[model samples]
Target: MRRRQFLAGGTTLLATAVAGCGHPSVVLDMDEATAADIANQVSISPEPGSAEYTVVSAAIENASSTRRGRSELFDRTDTVRIGDSFYEVSETPLESSEVTVYEVRLDFDPADSTAEIGEIAYEELPAADRQRLDPIISDDNPPSGDGYDVGIGYGTTQEVGDGSVFVPEQQYDIIVHNGDRYRVGVSTRTTTETEYRYEATAVTSGVDSFADRVRDQYLFTLTGLSEAEREVVEEAIDGGYFQDDEAFRSVTNRIREHEGLDVTDSYGTWLLEYEQVEYLTYVEW
Candidate 1:
C-alpha cells in the first residue's frame, strides 16, 4: 500500500494497493471535502479534545483504508456506497487500555468495495485482546442480551457544558471472569438525598449462545499497575468484589488510597474518583 503526497492544496489523497502478477493496483482518489464528509459520516473527527483514542483510530483507518479496503468494514450491513464518487465511510470502535477507539475508513471506488484483503482480517488479534476496543457509540435504550440480564442507569453527576447544549451521562460496569461467568453493575447520580443510585445483575452466557460466542472477546488492561497493585486488583476479583456493590466500592477506595504510585497514566484521572466510573456504557449518552 502506498499514497502519493498531497498536492499544494492538501485536498488530494491518492492511494494505491500493490498487487501481484495478474491484478493491477487499485487507486482511490479523494479530495479533502470527500475525506472530511466521510469522517463526519463515521463520527470520527480529528478535531481536538475528542478523546485521543478516537483520533488515533480515525487517523490510522483513514490512512490505511485509503490504500486498500479493510474487509472487516464489510461485516457491517449499514455500510453504503453513495454519491457520484461512490464514496464509502465507516467507523469501527475498538478498546485499548482505558479509552475507546473509532476507526474510520473511506473508499472512493465501487469496484474496490468487494475486494478481499486477507491481511486486514479481524482474526489478527486474539479474542481477549479484541474485546478491549469499543465503538463509543451510544443509544438511549440499553442493548439487550438474550439470556443475560441487561442493567442500565444514568449518573446523577452533571458535567458542565456550554449554555446551549447538555447531554445526560450514564455508566455500566461489567466483569467477565471467564467463559461462563460475568457480572454487571449500573450507576447514576440522583437529586435525592442519597445523591446516587445503582443496580446489578449476574449473568451466564450459555454455551454456544451469543454471549458465549463473544465470551473470549473480553479485554483487560493491567498495563500501569505495579506488581503489588496488580495483586490487589487480582485479589479483589478473586474475592468476588465486582459481584457485590459494597465489596466493589471497598476495593475501589483501597486502590485510590495508594498514594505511593500514580495510577493516573493508565487508568485516567476518572478512576481517582471511583464514583465516576461505569462499566458497559460511556460517560455521556
Candidate 2:
C-alpha cells in the first residue's frame, strides 16, 4: 500500500515489549499531548543521512513486519540514530485484532532532548521489504470470518459480519519516561472502521445560533429541554461561557444542580440517548 494510505489506518493501543536481557519490558502508554508533540516534529520528507531518514533506514533494515506474534525466540534488536543519540529499536507485531498491529519501540538511553521520530515514504522502501509488508498493510487482504471484539467509538457504530476490518495507518512516536532511558515509539490501532456510521439523532448545523453551535461542536442535543433550562443554556452560550473550560464546567454544574440536565462540559458523549444511523450527515466544520 502507499504511505498515506498506510497512515490513514493508524489507531491507538496500549501494549508492552521486552527490551532484552537486564532491561525491563515497558508499557506503551501514549497520551494526546505526547502524541501531538512527536507528530509536530515528524519529517514526511527528509534529506539522506539526516536523523529522520537514518531512523527510517534503520527501521527498514530491522524490518520484522512479516512476524506473526510476540515470541521470545523470534525477538530481534537493532540500533537507530535520533540526532546525536542512538536508541535500541525493536518491532513487535501483535495479533490481537483481525489485522496485525505492529509496535515499533525505541529506547532512549539518558533521554536526549534532540531525539525525534517520523514517517518514511513507502516508495523509499526496498522492493523486497515492501513485498513482505503488503499483506500487513494492504486493504486487498481481507480478514477471515473471525470477528473483532473491540467496541465502537462515539458518533459511529460498526456493522455485523466480515464487512468491518481494522486498517493500520501512519506510525507516530510517543515519549514515555522510564528512569534514565526514556521509552519512545509508535504502535498501530484501528483509526478507520469501514462499517461505522453515525447515530440517527445526530444532527449537523452551521454557524447559525448559539444552540446550533453547541450541537455542532459538542454533540449536545437540545431537543428535550425545558423552557427554563433552554433559556439558561442559551444565555450561557450567548455570554461565551462555553468557550472557556472553567466557565463551561461551572455552567454545566449549575444546570445539573438546579435544572437536573444530563450534560457534560466536554465533547463526544451524547447528553441524551439517540438512535443509530447507517451514515453521517456531511457538515462543514
Candidate 3:
C-alpha cells in the first residue's frame, strides 16, 4: 500500500513544452525510449487531436499522477504503462473490501488474506448467567422457536424527563450443535414505563461452510492466479457450496482425496491448505 515516489528526470523537454498551459501536464520525467515504448504499446496515432490520441493521452496523464506501479495500475487500465510492467487487469473485482479503495492497497499479498467472519471460538458465560439461561433450554425446540429471536440488535439512549433512559441492547446466545457453534440474538427495547419490545430473531453468525472458508483464505491467491486455476476455486464458491451441505461435503471430500497433488503452483498450495482446514458448524439452540 506504500505510495511510489515519483522519479525526477528524462521528460524535461515534455515538461518544458507543457509548462504554464493551465492544467497539470500529462508529461512526467520519462525518458525518450520509455515514452516511445509506451506510445507504441498504446498505438497512439500521430494526429495529436484524434480520438485515440486524446484517450491514450488522458489515461497516461491520470496514471502518472494516480498510479505509478504495476500493482497500482493492476485493475485500472492496460493501455497506460506506469513503469516496466503491463498488467492483465481482471474484470471481476477481488473479493475484498481492502481492494475496493484505490488509496489503500497498491499491492496484494496472498498470505495476508483473512476471513470476513474471522476467528470464532466458544467463550464461557458466567456461572450465574449460565444457571439462569439453563431454565430456557429446550432441546426439543431450537433457538428459532416462535417466542425466541436471533441476530444483531441496534438501539439508542434517549432523555426521559431529566434523566436518560438506556434501552435494552441486543443479547447473544451461543449454541453448540453438530460440532459447530452459532450465535443467536434478539433486540430488546423499553416501549413505555412498563412495556418492552423485542424483534429481529435470526441466526447471525457461525454459518460458514467449506467453500466460504476457502474463499476467505485464498482470495488474494485466486486473484493472482490464471483463469484456469482461479476457475476451479471460483466454481466451488459460486456453485452453492456455502448453502448446500451436500455440496460442501463433496468439496471437502474432493480436497481430502487430492492430498497428494503437487504444491509447486499457487493453486496447488492453496488446495493443500484447503484440505487441512477444519470446518465447523453451529446452529441456534
Best by TM-score: 2
Residue-by-residue lDDT tens digits, candidate 2, 63-177: 4223222232112213232333333344343333243333333333333434345333444444533444344334333232222212222111221222212113323232222
Candidate 3 runs further than 4 Å off: 1-123, 138-178, 194-285
TM-score of candidate 2 to 2 decimals: 0.19
User: Over the full model, what C-alpha lDDT does candidate 3 score relative to the true structure?
Assistant: 0.27
Best to worst by TM-score, what's the order?
2, 3, 1
Look at candidate 1 and tell me the lDDT of residue 20: 28
The lDDT of each candidate is: 0.25, 0.28, 0.27
Question: Per-residue lDDT for 235 in model 3?
Answer: 49
TM-score, structure 1 vs. true: 0.14
Lowest summed lDDT window (length 10), candidate 1: 276-285
- Better model by lDDT: candidate 1 vs candidate 3: 3
lDDT of 1 by residue, 1-285 (tens): 212122111111111111222322222221122323322222212334433233233433454221111123322222222211122234453322221212211121122223232212233323422333222112233343443344322222222121111112211122222222222222333232211111111122222232221223321222355555445444432321123234334444444344311123322111121122211100000
Tens digit per residue, CA lDDT, model 3, 1-285: 100111111122222333434323111111111333323322112256643334344544453112111122222123322233222222222322211111101011122223322322223443433343344433345344343333222222322111211113222233443444444333343332211111111111222332343335432211234454344444433321122344334443344334311122211212223233321111000
